[model samples]
Target: MRGLSWQIGLRYSMDRSGNQLVSFLSRLSMLGLILGVALLVVVLSVMNGFDQEMRSRILSLVPHITFQPWQQDRGDWQTLKAEVEQHPSVTAAAPFLQGNVMLIKGNAVEPSLLLGIDAAAERKVSRVGDFVDLGLLEGNREGLVLGDALAKKLGVEVGENISLGIPQSSDSNDVRFAKLPVLATVATGTELDQQLLLSSLETAARLLPSGQTLSLRVSIDDVFNAPRVAWELASVHGQDYIIRDWSQQFGNMYHAIQMSRKLVVIMLLAVVAVAIFNVVSTLVMVVNDKSADIAILRSQGASQGDILRIFLVYGAVIAGVGALAGGVLGVLLALGIGDIVAAIENALDMKLLQSDVYPINYLPSALRWGDIASVCGTAYVMSLVATLYPAWRASRMPPAEALRHG
Candidate 1:
């Protein structure tokens, strides 16, 4: 069997014109495979990276589940949190006070979303403490943790004091304003970095004349299970509160990434298709150049099927070689591009990962095995299909007439 295979390979290689045509076709195939694989790897990696970054920045700070009452602006958060915790999917639940408030520091003023959370409870649900440095609550109900951008805008440092004022009551003429001490600085490269504030729930409750908590934050066992868990929680809680998922708030960006990924796939497929066509053309040329040999084989009682198989195997070799080369090259390029770009950016003193300009920094690449397999498989299949017609045409040649003419 091994000797037979070697004989077939030797015959295939000895056909000079056939080998040249196949080599040319193989080069074109390699070009297509290289581009397609490289693009697929790079794009999917980028999308995966972006998706991960978004999840980390958004989910790390925001709860997987948020409970906001439908009819009432405020609710008994402690009771609701306790009730929600009974569910197996529910991991930790915390009370939160959320409202729009203004911060005044060193003659500069900025508007922000005031999130009042119990320090201990927040630790259970989110990573606020890790992001926040230089904060000491110590039961100081009037302390605040400010976003890094907001702090810079207000020209306030970690130890600096800032004035936080709630809107005065409409009916009463008292000019009392809620002022707080700035305790910490948080710098997460997100929208929250510019317009989010952290304070004690007690302080928030006191600031509001109504003295009510608006929402309760819940963290689930798995983040991807947020919607399912939220649905179950809502089913249990009844119509009093509405469930909100991170997707609902940020679906546009996710959808955009998905659309871009699809477009990339289409583009890469076009390149592969072009490569297949090149292979088909190369096979046709090979069949023409090997017509004399084909005639001899036909006279030797070789079946048409055998002739087709030989040519098919020849095309397969070319396609397989190119696919292998492309796959290896693509992976190497994808894995190293991020580090290469980062290094260049650093040497040039240019911020490739700009926090102030963009939401996140650092080029991210995440290659999936599925994408690689799909690209390589598609190339091989296309190349084989493309070989059929030309090989079949060569196989059907008249052996007697060709031998007499030659």
Candidate 2:
């Protein structure tokens, strides 16, 4: 280290450019790094937030698995339930009636899916009890819970009577409707906000005017594995009934969330990569300006490999510093984005993001360690690679040629 002092000092001094042009380039490199990392972090965090929101909103409303009868009133109800309950994965089971019905209130008609569920047993599988506010389902057989958005659309409220009209199946064409009393309203964000309603299985079946057959609604301990478990249940029970997992029930929404996340990631990465190219160009210019010093070192026993490594190490250091700073900035921005947007919106006296219009009301973020680590590591690695060609060319310059040019 002592013997190499002069060379190290020379190299350090040569790095200090005497012009504002070089200063501007240095600032630009840092700026590019900052922008790249900040955007990457915030984008990934927002995607994570959206993904988490999807699961919370969707999973809370529906059961993990539904054992549907192949046809209405088609199978042995009690025996199938007993066989399905025997599976280790199945924690709770209850019979249900699923049918489409029309809601009629004083001449206004709206189509709605009528779900028949056992009041007491449905609680184990669905969050119907939490959704109920006024009338107890046990006391009233015709009681129903409407989604808040749906209720708004239909102009119905708690304790109001809404006639549920189930279309007659036979071609005989007798007009009949099942009139049910509204019990409560449920609020769950998403399209489910507008369509879903809850009612007793007895009421649902009665509304259908169809004979009751036990179509089981099952809840398993592991929700992510619901599809596999549902298939297992079907396999074990000989597939007499149609078994559906939550994934199948909400396939389109699930795929849309995944695609959105991927698209966001891709776009962010493309932006970051372009910014990183600025860092590459800046390092290349620095190498070009130091060619004479590099040649002198080559003459004084510094191997080509050592010169290459020294510049590579310097680039790595710069990248590491930039990445660390950018990551900190990103996390801070994400964590405070809600407050920041809220302040902006309040000052303007307008809503920036309305939940009714957008899925969420504010800028949501989730700063995950995995995403941060991946971004930082990738930036550092790219910076290191960016140094290679420039550093190699600097080290390979002939001493006679470099000194004459200088």
**Highest-scoring model, lDDT:** 2
lDDT of each: 0.73, 0.74
RMSD of each: 4.3, 4.0
How many pairs of residues in model 2 come into backbone collision? 1
Q: What's the TM for model 1?
A: 0.79
Residues 1-406 of candidate 2: C-alpha lDDT, one tens digit per residue: 3336444534542455544565577567767787788888888888787777656655756888877666665787788778878888888888877776888877677888877777788777766566564235565457788877788878888888888767666575655766667878877555566777888766676667556566888888777888789878878664567778888867666677679888987887777777678777776776666677777877887877777776666566567767888888988888988788889999999987654555555666778999999998888788768768876776687878878775
As a whole number from 0 to 100, the lDDT of residue 152 in candidate 1 is: 84
Candidate 2 structure lDDT: 0.74
lDDT of 1 by residue, 50-125 (tens): 7776777667777888888875555676788788899998889887777667788768988777887778878889
Which residue window of length 10 is worst by lDDT in model 2?
A: 1-10
Q: Which stretches of candidate 2 lie over 4 Å from their true place?
A: 1-17, 54-57, 74-76, 105-109, 128-135, 170-173, 178-181, 236-239, 290-310, 336-364, 398-406
Best by TM-score: 2
